[model samples]
Target: MRSPRRGNAFEQAEAAFKAATKKNEPMPKAPVTPPAGKEMVSLRLDRDVLAHFQDDGPGWQARINAALRAAAGLDPA
Candidate 1:
C-alpha cells in the first residue's frame, strides 16, 4: 500500500505565503518629550585622562560632564 502524502507543494507554498503576509497587531505609541538642550558630539581625550574617569566604574560619563562644567565655570543644574 502507498503511504498518504502530508501536503502538496502548491498548498504548502500558499499557506506559507498567507502566513508571511498576515499583519500583526499594531504597537502602542510611547509618550513624546521635548529635548533637554543637550547635543551629541565627538570628543577625543588622552588615554590616561579617559582611564582616570572610567576607573570609578559607573557614572564616569556624568563625572566627566560635571568636571567639564566646573572647568568652564558653569553652575551645576
Candidate 2:
C-alpha cells in the first residue's frame, strides 16, 4: 500500500502546487494624453485634397484644422 501524506506534508504540497499554477501578470500601462489637448489620429485624405492644403506651405496642418472647424460650425482652434 502507498504511504499516506501526514501533518504539514499535504499543506507543503498544496503550497508548491499553488505556486507553480499561479499566473504572472504584467503591470497595466497608463493612458497617454496629448500635451496640447489634441488627440493624434491618422487621417486618409485624397491626394488632390492633401495637395490643396500643402500648397499653402508650413502651416498647412493648422489651416486644415481651421477649415474643418469652420465647416463644422465650431469656433476656430
Candidate 3:
C-alpha cells in the first residue's frame, strides 16, 4: 500500500477527481424536481397582508388557503 502522500495532496486528489469526472455517465447529483408533499416553508407576511389576516383572526390563514385553492379551481370546498 502507498504511504502518506507528499506535498500537494489536493493537487493529486484534484487530478484524480477530474479523471473520474471524465467518464461517460449521467451527473451523479440530486435531481431537480418539484418537491413532494412534504418539506415546506412558511414566510412572515408583508405589513398589509399581515394586518388583513390579523383583523380576520384565527382562521385567516385557512381562509387564504381556501381562497387560493378556489381561485386555482382546486375545489376548496
1-77, model 2: which lDDT tens digit per residue? 97876658888899999999999897899997766867788999999999999997998988988888899989745
Q: How do the predictions measure up, each by TM-score?
A: 0.53, 0.51, 0.37
lDDT of each: 0.89, 0.87, 0.75
TM-score of model 2 vs. true structure: 0.51
Worst 10 residues of 2 by lDDT: 32-41
Tell me the TM-score of model 3. Answer: 0.37
Q: What is the lDDT of candidate 3?
A: 0.75
Query: Candidate 1 residues 1-77, lDDT tens each?
Result: 98987699899899999999999998998877535976677899999999999999998988998899999989655
Minimal lDDT window, size 10, model 1: 32-41
Question: How close is each model in CA RMSD to the real structure?
Answer: 4.7, 10.2, 9.8
Candidates 1 and 2 compared by lDDT, better number: 1
Q: How would you encode candidate 3's per-residue C-alpha lDDT over 4-60 as one tens digit per residue? A: 875598998988899988868676898776456534458777899767766977988
lDDT measured at residue 10 in model 1 versus the true structure, 0 to 100: 93
| Rank list by lDDT | 1, 2, 3
